[model samples]
Target: MALRANRVRLGIFFVLIMGIFITGIFWVAGGFSSPVTTSYACYFGWSVGGLNVGSTVEYNGVPVGSVSAIEIAPDGRLVKVVLNLEDDKFRVDDTIVASLFFTGITGLQDINLESLPDSVERLWSEDQLTFESDMPVVPVRSGTVQSVASGLNAVFQSMAQVDMKELNDQTIRALTRMNDLLDSVENDSVAVRLSRTIDNFDAVLVTYNDLGNELTAAIRDAREDAEPIVEDLKEFTGELDNLSEQLNMMGADLHNTFNVTNSILQEIRELLPNVNRLLDGFSGGYRGEEIWQ
Candidate 1:
């Protein structure tokens, strides 16, 4: 019984050791405290050559998640990559863009997420998905390689659409016309004519300047000649003012003479009336004397 008890106790100790070893492994492997992650899907129209499962997903260059799965879409026209991202690290919306980027020269590629400017309008609601998938779909943009390739393709297509032969003919005709115009100008002595015209214009300008100076001088001389006339006019006006004063004095003297003559005439008229009355009285006396005689 003692040996059996020892075995049981030893077995229990062994079981406890194994439990602790498992727990330590789980802790080291991050199984005990796994972060809460959300799944998001991205559909790429072009090739995803270097991207694979377990590839890093970066938000503005910071790793925030890892690719969980990669497969072809149901339509078989696109590659769908699923990302398991830590929750609350960043918000996912229509304005967020996912693009592939080469991590190194070894051709390893990763998905990078970036948000557009805040002023950009959100095209879809948060709950809306572009593809019929359980995970929310993040819009995928062309990678650098794909963008370069697309630009080259477009350039080639545009070149192919151009009428090169006609363009070349037009260009040749333009060059020929330009050369003919140069030859015509040279043969017609256009440069010499232009020089002669410029010289004539300069001569005319000089002549106009001389005429302006002469006109200014003539105006100054005329003004000087009129100065004596203006002074004579001032003297004539002063003489007229003196004559008017003399006329006013003569008028005052004539008015005084008229007043004196009227006063003398009035006295003489009064005396004449008295004399007539005296004569009448004297005549009446003479008549009485004659009657008496």
Candidate 2:
């Protein structure tokens, strides 16, 4: 009987140990004890762990719950997810946002979770709320490179389609015209005329230089001769001034003498006429025989 009792006690202990081990396994797999639930509503296109479970719930890099259902009402697309959060920081009305991020050099993709700006104070609860994700903005490097390549291709195509024969003909025509113009200038008599003109210019310059020297010498001689003539004229003008003073007094005496001569001439003219009349009367009396009367 004691041996059976011992066996039964061992069995009970073994079962308890097995139960504890099973409970620990479940706890480890489930990732914690009964955490507080922070319910929220997520949009339809959000995903978790490569699986878009309609609207999924996550907290601190661990999946907590999945979307129970989805519906579209007048307020827009609504998604409801059941959350099992371990902390009180995640509560109702908190904004949930998802972001796509790249990992590894091969550009593997993963979704990152973050609360929307100012979503901390407004925590989520068991209520219909909105969740948003930034729109994916594609980089435009490849488009820019393709545009540059297209421009280069158009330029090369234009150059390749050029007419080489027409260009060569134009070049040849230009060279021939240049040769003809050169030949015309070479055959003209302009070179001989230019030489003659240069010789005449040289002779003219020589004549001009000789005439300039002659004019310089003539000016010097004229200035030397004019000096004495100027002094002589000055002395002559002084003498004429004195002679004019004496002539002025002599003219007054000549005026008085001329008046006396004019009076004597007038008396002589009157006596001549009276003497002729007296002679004519005496001659007539003698001729008529009574001369005394």
Candidate 3:
């Protein structure tokens, strides 16, 4: 029985040794916990948020280092956080920023390390530290959201205080005035006056039509009566033409009688002078014969 108990104890011891040997082989082969000595410093006026000593440092989302120390200058102006990296990662001669970032809304913050393009050799010595709040200039999304919400609240409050009664009263007054205007236009007296004016115009048109017809009939009668008299005047004109020819012949004969009388008068003028001379000689001879007797 004692031999059997010793065999079981030896078996347990062998299993324990094999387990530790396998774990050591796996750890060495996987190259876990490979530490590299690289130093980085925070600038003056910069901060690492809430990170403390021994906090894990990440580079490009991969674990590369850890925070070794955090300190403030004797002047109380500059803060510094030194990190030791195991991934051969080193900072250039430029400024680096350390910020606090939350992966979600859970308020759990992590250390975010970033480098700036300023001269680090001019500010910090080798293995020294510095810090700043304006290192990366984190934008405040929550603050902007709060400002927008406040503006919307003020607009809604102003709208709630408006008075609607005056607007409704003005609308009602306008509607009442429009109804009264329509009622006045629909009155029976106005309709009757329009109808009478139209009837008077129709009567005037009928009177003008009757006058036109009378004037046309009078013109037709006058034309018919003057046509017969015009024919009689034409016949009278032919008789007047024959009478003018007879009068012309009689005027010619009267002109010839006047010419014959003028010739007889001229002969009598010549014979009168000869007869006077003969009568004078006979008178003187008769007087002497009477004396001799």
The top-ranked prediction according to TM-score is 1
lDDT of 3 by residue, 173-274 (tens): 555654555455435444454465456556555655654565455556766676644554454464446445544544544454454445545554554454
- For model 1 the local lDDT of residue 118 reads 59
Tell me the number of clashing residue pairs for each predicted model.
0, 8, 13
TM accuracy, model 1: 0.54
lDDT of each: 0.67, 0.44, 0.50
What are the candidates' C-alpha RMSDs?
45.9, 50.3, 55.3
Write one digit per residue (lDDT tens) for candidate 1, span 147-181.
56655565555566555676566556555654654
Whichever of 1 and 3 has more lDDT, that candidate is: 1
Give the local distance difference test score of model 1: 0.67
Task: List candidate 1 segments past 4 Å from native.
Answer: 1-32, 104-106, 116-134, 186-192, 214-293
Best of the two (2, 3) by TM-score? 3
